[model samples]
Target: MAFREMFSKNHRTTDAAPPASTETGRDDTSFYDLKHKIHGRLIEETNLAALDSMDPAEIKTEVGGVVEYFLQEEQALLNEEEKRQLIVEVLNELMGLGPIEPFLKDPTISDILCNTYKDIFVERFGLLEKTSARFIDNAHLMNIIDRIISRVGRRIDESSPMVDARLPDGSRVNAIIPPLAIDGPILSIRRFAVNPLKMQDLVNYRTLTPQIAEFLAGCVKAKLNIMISGGTGAGKTTLLNILSGFIPANERIVTIEDSAELQMQQPHVVRLETRPASIEGTGTVTQRDLVRNSLRMRPDRIIIGEVRGAESFDMLQAMNTGHEGSLTTIHANTPRDSLTRLESMILMTGTNLPESAMRFMLSSALDLIIQSTRLTDGTRKVTAISEVVGMEGEVITLQDIFVFEKKGVDKDGKVLGRFMATGIRPKFADRLELAGIEVPEDLFSIDRYYE
Candidate 1:
């Protein structure tokens, strides 16, 4: 027998039923069996031939009709309460998509925003476009949110109705409901590329050129403390992952993230993810908690997936104190903004450090900042490669070793720019020499840039 046919008769519907309804008088094993039976029977009885002809919504409606037929056939065996519960179960199975499909299938969409049941928006190429994909209603949306958070061992309700989770595909999910959201349910999904984009692939997309790629590789090889900066959908994490490829395959790496999206190709990579508190408000693992813990693991390179909040302070401390060649990303518009953002995050640690002290720490901890931007033409590109040159009094000083100079726009509305080098050789090059990596002195000559 086929798989669906086998499940139709022998499988228990209990597994598919809602948790609330599972408590009903029905036996879970029997209910699970009936559900699979109904699903198989519904598909058989319906116009399976015409399935391709119908829209997804219409197909769902027709499937609902089959469910009603199955319920009527079993009406004599079930009481009124059991029958009512079955109706809800059938509808949920037919109408609700498990919370993982939209994120995996969408190639162009970078982010999925769910403000409420009625509002859904997805960011495609830097523009937010409304989508027809939606839940059955607010209640249905809440059910999915419940199912998802429950699997991750998180919680959501009136009292603690906000949650952060990762779908099976590693897409980051943030959800807020009821009192906290006030707009029914709010869910934001930051989609991850199921297949991580590699550096060569990014170059094929015109995101960066080969020369800049070699330079970034050199920076990674030289153990330059590098931070990637960008706005939402600006490809900061993607660039970070690609840059991480330059690390020698022999070195041990520790990657820390809230959701664990970085796909480092190194064989010795240790992945650490943060944990959420249980329903009773116990067993929480914050990013700060993980960063501090990763320190003891003796990573050749410690990479915090993204530095936000107090974790920035610990990450900066790690880079300054023996963790060279460390990597992290930040949300900012420009390289300077990235430094300011780091300062703000460091202060979030509640250190109460003076502004000058924070600036000094940032300047000393960071060696290079690669800033990326999503241009008006709907493409994200690396715009500047800057070197941190220590602090001047109250201000952190930086020199752009390489910058993207946009000459002009093409007729097709694409922005054209060249990543040119500056004469300033990074202070860490001497250390790279000891590692048997030789970057020609002329590679950093500003006059030779764009030649």
Candidate 2:
């Protein structure tokens, strides 16, 4: 049951969903106005400073008592059930992110997008659906946005209209307000699983087969540097997390990101997050700085959340300088594009290295590129796993070890695809053998396909 419904026993939790809104109907508008009046009075009468020190139940009880007193005094036309729900809504507005708290608790929702005060959209099971939830006004939405960014020591205002932040649970949050936003305010939340997903979960979701999972685990154990390439919302981080799980517990690992998103399960992990510049236009830390710093920390593995800027050069140096087994994700459509993006980032460092040198560095540094894609049917799948086969003349060669071949969609619009081995044993298999990790012969057999 929702927090509001649980407040009163008389209010039965029914299958019927309430108007997915704050102030659409006349009753809703009146209730909203009443809520604001009570909210203002509570802010004045209640001890706001003591709220943080008290237990959630205690705060609810204290505030609920006050709300009850005011409800009788105001003589609002509401039933007992409605009165109880009002208190819960008030608590949510005061203590939580207002209308979006319930959505945050839902595991099935992968994304929460707020275009404005009146438009709230959430992605459930990879499909976008509009919710009736809304804020009182643009100011209300901006207040919630401020609460989110301020916790992370991030500032979002006229001088800095865009800010990237995270919730307490590590969900990625981005808020862009006026001037740049054009609209009143925009908030996008990319939710993470409370319990980190395991390899079995990926297999269960058909993101990859058991064989593919085993091969990836072996690659990680073998200390082969892997790159996850995908577009936005393509499950790159999730795949990166699963791959990182294969790293042995004894090794020291360091994670660097614009925001700390990788949920590394290792005991010996050092997390470093980048910082935005202050209003004075100073005190900013970039991913390149963290990547260079992680090198001195003696990390057996350096897992970058994403290689977006000049950090790619330092990353390649780390990879070539015996810091193997590193992992990262890049926003790209295919394996070739990932290489091009990496090349471009290297050029951004003002390194006078020629094209051939860059290609050689890339071919030697990255061992594997796992391409993840969200199909038209909203199903995410590992589209291809390509191995960097070193340079052939001026060009770097790549060979696919595994690929997902798409057929046609089913009647229900479910994507039809089969994971297949390319019958080519990746050169990394030698690295696995060197590390004493066994690679099953059937794993690379073309006939051994996963339907």
Candidate 3:
């Protein structure tokens, strides 16, 4: 009688149970268990090594088996369509990223930055925003990273914990793991658009006004040595790509970069990318290596992605020698500072050239400096277009043809700025005239110019 009363009390308590945190915990455990099972089976039946070697279609064939197994196992627990949906979830977790596939497919997302497991962000429409996607854990994240690098025949390990790679879609990737990244693994992906931006797109986006665009087009046509300067993520490469479109399509264009990112519209273009040192610390091809080799390629125009180190000296020499109309990008804050940065970078070459000699070389090789800035509103615009008139004694003389005057921000937090002519006509106008390029006579007139 006592045992029956105890059982009856227990049954009554279960029927009147309060909200159970354990129930929520059990649900999470079940989800993880299903994911783990799918992950294990994917590794087993997929012939992990062969899967690594297979083409995308073959890999998907293996992935389909894992998906079918997952559907079969979950069918009784879920309705027909729900089981089908679960199959997608399992395949996403096993074969590739599940819910984040759409974001990866979206061409507008130029970058995907992950600060942590939960704090994912993407750059879209030239702006960064937090994304609602994540990897299950660090292991899953590492697997994806490793898969990408392996396909490119690269490696990362304790001895070399950092890697730079490009995705099949031409997105540049830099990843660093633990000892170097104390917080967690960090990945920075810079996406490249398959379609190169046309000059009109730049004008429509207000990167530069139409008048400025016309002026730059004339400069390119006239074979002016141009240096584009900007800070990190300042859209230097994009601007360089657009400027390259100004080159006559028939000219033989050669491009050198640490990684091949520029997509020029020119017909006869050759691109060279640097290679890192191999595991034995031998057989490395650097930007300087390719820059020196590019000289022998008989290039009509040579464009370096960015002159960051000793290669600046080589680039300057190329420009000074017969490589007119050459273009490149450099990291700097202002037009004047760009000259200083060039000098500093050239000094890195250990040439031991006197500072005055370096200044003279730069003043002659670089005819114009275009300074670009990413404003507080995340808009990148060319702030100044300055002319290098040649060295004034020890100093490089500069004249600003166009200046961006900040008119402050609007109610929407967007920057308001105007590009105004500084009333100084470039001395290179004579060269343009000789090239049969017509410069608007009113371009130099203050009254006739539009602000």
Best by TM-score: 2
> Residue 120 deviation, candidate 3, in Å?
1.5
Rank by TM-score, highest first.
2, 3, 1
lDDT values for all models:
0.77, 0.88, 0.77
lDDT of 2 at 213: 89
lDDT minimum window of 10 residues, candidate 3: 1-10
As for TM-score, the candidate ahead, 1 or 3, is 3
Cα-based lDDT at residue 288, candidate 1: 93
- Predicted candidate 3 versus true structure: per-residue lDDT over 272-330, tens digit per residue: 98888789988889888898999999999999999888888898899999999999999
Ranking by lDDT: 2, 3, 1
Q: Local error of candidate 2 at 12, Å?
A: 35
Distance (Å) between predicted and true CA of 262, model 1? 1.3
Q: What is the C-alpha RMSD of each candidate to the true structure, in Å?
A: 9.7, 6.7, 9.5
Each prediction's TM-score against the native? Answer: 0.77, 0.92, 0.85
Candidate 2 ranges beyond 4 A from true positions: 1-29
lDDT of prediction 3: 0.77
Query: Mind giving the per-residue lDDT tens digits that candidate 1 earns over 42-149?
Result: 545444555556676665556655555455454324566755555555545544443335444778778888878777888887678887655556886787777767
